[model samples]
Target: MSGGCAVTLDDLTVALRALRLLAVDFPHLPAPDVDVSPVFPEWLRLSLHDTSCESLSAFEQWRTALRIAPEAVDSRTQSGGRTRVLKAEGQFAGAVIVLTAYADEPAADRAPAGQAGGVR
Candidate 1:
């Protein structure tokens, strides 16, 4: 296999192992949205949609379970800063795995129409 193909295989293996671990360790968490593209086979992303509180809690727990450092935690916004996603990156079996968790929408965005009082 080409080097990229081998790395992709490794990434898939790591992602499956991580998912199995999370299923066993954090059964209450909903299944994440798994994504892997042939174009970017070196990385894997598992995204969870949960309340920020719940997502943050799970992120910490998963990182601890994976033995990833607490300092790995980070965050970024999407939808022009209206959506925030908590993120952590770690390696399993030498393959990069990224865990991202975010709520369906920001609290302010979820406010009843016209309640938050901002222009559309």
Candidate 2:
């Protein structure tokens, strides 16, 4: 974890504040699936799964809210052409926040449950 910020109580506080902002600022969107890692460089990952347009829009909104540079965003198609993921990273009050969204694909192309679903 070299070059990573050390996790601290302050980082958790920042994460909570960000969550609150999401709730208040974007009420139309569904609750995001969230993940918090307490290891070095503590991070919070928020994700949504829906139509490509919706997810992509959510990603854009979050990236703007977090003030992440547009150059930081990255997108790639999955191996099977079932879905694509767009990701971006930013720092908020010493906490790393990662925003991701999965674009939906045809139901028949999806993998079985408990298998290689998507990036976690």
- Residue runs of model 2 more than 4 Å from their true location after superposition: 1-14, 21-30, 105-120
TM-scores, all models, native as reference: 0.58, 0.64
Question: What are the runs in model 1 whose C-alpha is more than 4 Å off?
Answer: 1-30, 104-120
Candidate 2 lDDT over 1-120, as tens digits, reads 433566566556656676666677777665678876555335678897787568778778778877899888886656455687888899865667888988866677666655564543
Q: What is the C-alpha lDDT of each candidate?
A: 0.63, 0.72
Worst 10 residues of 2 by lDDT: 1-10
Per residue, candidate 1 scores C-alpha lDDT tens digits across 1-120 of: 245434546545655665566568767655667786555554667776775557667666667766778677776555554455678888764557788777545656544543432223
Backbone clash pairs in model 2 (N, Cα, C under 3 Å; residues 3+ apart or in different chains), count: 0
Lowest-scoring 10 consecutive residues by lDDT in candidate 1? 111-120
lDDT (0-100) at residue 120 of candidate 1? Answer: 33
